[model samples]
Target: MNKLLKTISVSVLGAAMLSPVLSTVVFAATAASEQQATRNLVQQLSNIKSFSANFEQTTKATAGTKPAQRTGLSAQHMNQTFVGEMKVERPGKFYWETKTPAKQTIVTSGKTVWIYDPDLQQAVRQTLDDQVANTPALLLSGNTAQIMQAYRVAQPDQSKTYYRLYPRVKDSAFQSLTISFGTNKAPNMMVLLDSLGQTTSIRFNNVKVNPSIPASVFNFTPPKGTDIINQ
Candidate 1:
């Protein structure tokens, strides 16, 4: 997986939303329908008992080159058993683990949100909201309040009923964000374009509504002797 995803603290992955297999793949909807559906799903997210899903992602599309592919698995419960895991085979094979409220991330070979390279030599730290925006977890988790607070939600082009997200705070990290509904009922995919026009796309699959998972999934304890640092 891309080491960068682990940065979402949702990599510990950035998440929220329904899965492709779960989503019906909506072709188009009336403007009002799109708006209402987006709003409805946003509300449904908060009420859903528990959720789980799998997804595929590709970062940096290059001409004549196959994009790096990744598989993501995530699950969240009412009390925050938020768990998202992503595996990417690229420059190398890597994994991302996240726990919320704190929304922490641990990366490969000594890098992370919880553990930084210059990370005071192996201590864990907390990530701020700006850092939080970079995660796929936030998108997948479907925390509309958090999403609405951080991004100015809009529909840029009327041709397609896609919901676009603009970072309200205005930072150098990303240029624009857009997410699409699979069947005008459930969220299926997210496309994030950074300042460089380089894009990261995540598609949700195998969604399990009202899942029967446990809260322990969201909790983590670092290896013994691993340093601890709090932001």
Candidate 2:
């Protein structure tokens, strides 16, 4: 459970150099532009009522960073990949199922979240409060105002639709988050960098925006004989 939680916190949540001797006026102008860009990004995310996508997630150590060792696998083999499906609805509801590398399902119904591991026949239930809602995992389904307050958004290239968000809080789960949008202005990819120097990249495929999703999709019930832990 500890391992799973760590993965969720780092891989799920998760930027930049500046020119020296830049003028104060230039700096002010840049800050104003970034603020506007942040608002625009927030609006784009707010417009999403429902989202569903097939995703490929890859995790690797940063260059020059030592990779953590795992049983039967050397540090050089630390890179891991997983394919998954994700669904989200506005106001705190989402479903994430990892299909390969390992099978795990995480679903939340506004008020509560459930993490299920089929192999272990275990399910962990957690309350979905403000703290949990602030995580990057729930970014699409969380409060936009809170998001705006928590991160400083920057769009390095106005020509491109990708935005990088730096956490305002020092103890944030990850170091930074980069979200990329397609030509249609739909999110297509996300990259998360953790403090431990691990990078997790998630690319979305067959993305659906504001689609009609059944409410049941956000609710999960452990099967018979499954051990349940509440947190």
Candidate 3:
């Protein structure tokens, strides 16, 4: 799942983890126009009623005992918050859905956060408390100012705005985060780096700036004959 994040971030920074990781895909920008353009983009984002995008996520790490990283796709919706279906592996095997507002319900499968598998019928619910770990949630829930608190905001090139951020807590799980905005001025891509020096990168495409989506997408109803796990 950690590796999956790196891939999805290529498209959506709407994920909010504790230390913070997010960004829009690269858009051309000029040094003279950086601050204003960014401000305009933020303002535009704040006014958006809905959004939909596709993400390509990728991850990498040093070879050896360290975990070998890979990537995948995350189809997403950014309303007041973020909700999406993503497969961490192929054939859409591992799918994670996000629902927001409650922050509590963002990753829920039922009243419980983890879904019960009828085959196993056993699911354990664990609160991934460290917001840094819930990058997707924060990315969709927060604004630019909130993100700036922990990251050193940088505009790397005339066409690219980047953010280099780290966790505020010394013991936070991640080492750093990088977010990139598109030259056209959209918050579209992000990259996360963990303490192990592993990196995950995500990109967004086919975006809908402000469109309508089904409310049911954010609601969770447990499957039939499944045990509700609360832990």
Candidate 4:
């Protein structure tokens, strides 16, 4: 279950460990304008120093067999939703805590990243740069060239609110990513398609941008008796 939760968290970073999803997917010349628009969007998001939001995360796995031919629902292809809260600050700080389906917290200060699972009584620690090195979430603190180098951006629809990002690297964790912005020009939703075609979708509500956040929120200390693993 801890492993599953870890995967869930990673999936949310979009192409990284689950809510941050935008990376290198280079496009053809025909998509020049759309690509430019994507850069513009990134520039806007980069200006935000802090962000908080309520999120509903749904993970849809692939079926082992064709459901159409199967008599019963396949657990392999089951869909699950988890409710959570997300907080982000510039220069590589983030916090995510799940309140339902299980209780877990993933926090990254500027220096270290911690993934804590209360039910398992364990926490994993690693350097922040290594954990988020190639993830889409790194875009929050990265430059436009970094984003453009990894992904090709395009707006598939007439609605400027939606943007599609495809990985230029063939070996990316997810196949593609799509992020939707609300009227306030803040990201309200993000969906990632993994290599296996499974989709991880997250919806953000009650989003507050550039709000002040306490420094302690990014720090974590394993509780008494909790096992700590350094990665």
Q: Which candidate is the best by lDDT?
A: 2
lDDT of 3 by residue, 113-186 (tens): 34433345444454434353335424443444555454433343433355445556676556666566554445
| Candidate whose TM-score is highest | 2
lDDT, candidate 4, 1-231, per-residue tens: 222222222222222133345555543333237656676667667667788899887766555635453322234424767788888887678788988877888887777778899999999887755325446544444445566677777765432556677878888766677777777666788776666545567788999988899989988999999999988
Q: Stretches of candidate 2 above 4 Å error?
A: 1-32, 67-77
- Lowest lDDT sum, 10 consecutive residues, model 3, at 86-95
Q: Write model 2 residue lDDT over 123-178, tens digit each, in one string.
A: 99988876677666678787788888988888766556678788898987678888
Per-prediction TM-score, please?
A: 0.53, 0.82, 0.55, 0.75
Q: TM-score: which is higher, 2 or 4?
A: 2
Off by over 4 Å in 3: 1-49, 63-137, 143-145
Q: lDDT of each model, Cα atoms only? A: 0.45, 0.74, 0.43, 0.66
Error at 208, model 2, angstroms: 0.8
Question: What's the lDDT of the predicted structure labeled candidate 3?
Answer: 0.43
In terms of lDDT, the poorest run of 10 residues in model 1 is 6-15
RMSD of 3: 12.3
Each model's RMSD to truth, in Å? 12.7, 6.6, 12.3, 10.0
List model 1 lDDT by residue over 1-231, tens digit each. 122342120111222456678974444433434455456446644554345555554455324433232122222211232344433221111234433323334442212234433223455555434454345434444345666566655543444435666666665455566666544334466676654334666666665554555433343456666677776
Could you tell me the TM-score of candidate 3?
0.55
